[model samples]
Target: MTSEKKTYNFLIAGVPYKLKTSHDDATVEELVEFVNSRMNQALGVTKNGSYQNAAVLTAMNLAEELILLKRKAHRELEKLEEKALQLSMDLENSKSNKVLNN
Candidate 1:
């Protein structure tokens, strides 16, 4: 079931934004907090960090993280698929052996 879009007002790095999203309030709040935290983390590490620099750094960091996570998930899915196929083959072999014995 799809929920109606909601208008949420949130602040990140002291800047306010109004967004229309299908996500629930808690999710929106959590996302806002995470972005703020990332921005702060970038600012803290960079020398002479402006908001623009921090924003770009945060975006890059998030992109790298997303790519890494996607790669990990894909590898995990491949392993799961391989295991499922092996299990299916084992079951088929077991059935064949049972019929041969009978």
Candidate 2:
């Protein structure tokens, strides 16, 4: 588990880029593929196929997805926590009722 960043060279939309990160080779490759796929989609849909514009749009799209996923995860976690709390309260009440009956 080395914390040092490693360099990864990849091409996106025919442009070369070097990324430095702490991710393993396979993880980095997956990330590169994801970005390249998004860039290609953006480039294909753009009127002029402007690389810069496509990249920016792709970034915005990825960011939007990330935010939405985070929000959905948060909501799900909250619901799970609420259910756990309710279950704990029910369990405590049942125990108290048993003790009183005994």
Candidate 3:
């Protein structure tokens, strides 16, 4: 994230739109391309191919991806934390065992 916020104009599904974002030109371009791709996919699968329906489907797909990634990252973090705690306990036990032997 950068401190500079700018406005960008791009087309999605052949529709022109303007967006204000803190991201750079490349990021804006990538986002527009990705959205268009998703919307096109949704439209392709539908019989009527309504833009509104396509938009809803695209939004749902993106939300599902976000939630799945978040859950995976959280589970990974928990595993790392658990491993760290186990290592710390083992070190403490080793230190106590050495003291007892002495």
Candidate 3 residue-wise lDDT, 1-102, digit = tens? 687899988888888899989998888888999999998899998779888888899999999999999999999999999999999999999999999999
Between candidates 2 and 3, the one scoring higher on lDDT is 2
lDDT against true structure, model 1 = 0.92
Inter-residue clash pairs, candidate 2: none
Instruction: Please give the distance, in angstroms, between residue 60's alpha carbon in candidate 1 and its true position after superposition.
Output: 1.0
For residues 1-102, what per-residue lDDT tens digits would candidate 2 score against the true structure?
Answer: 359899988898888889988889989888888988999999999999899899899999999999999999999999999999999999999999999999
Question: Which lDDT tens digits does candidate 1 get at residues 29-93?
Answer: 88999999999898898889788999999999999999999999999999999999999999999
| Top-TM-score structure, candidate number | 2
TM-scores for all predictions:
0.92, 0.93, 0.92
Give the alpha-carbon lDDT of every model. Answer: 0.92, 0.92, 0.92
Against the true structure, candidate 3 has what lDDT?
0.92
Q: After superposition, how far is residue 96 of candidate 3 from its true place, in Å?
A: 1.3
Residue 47, model 3: Cα distance from true site in angstroms: 1.7
Q: 91, model 1: CA deviation in Å?
A: 0.6
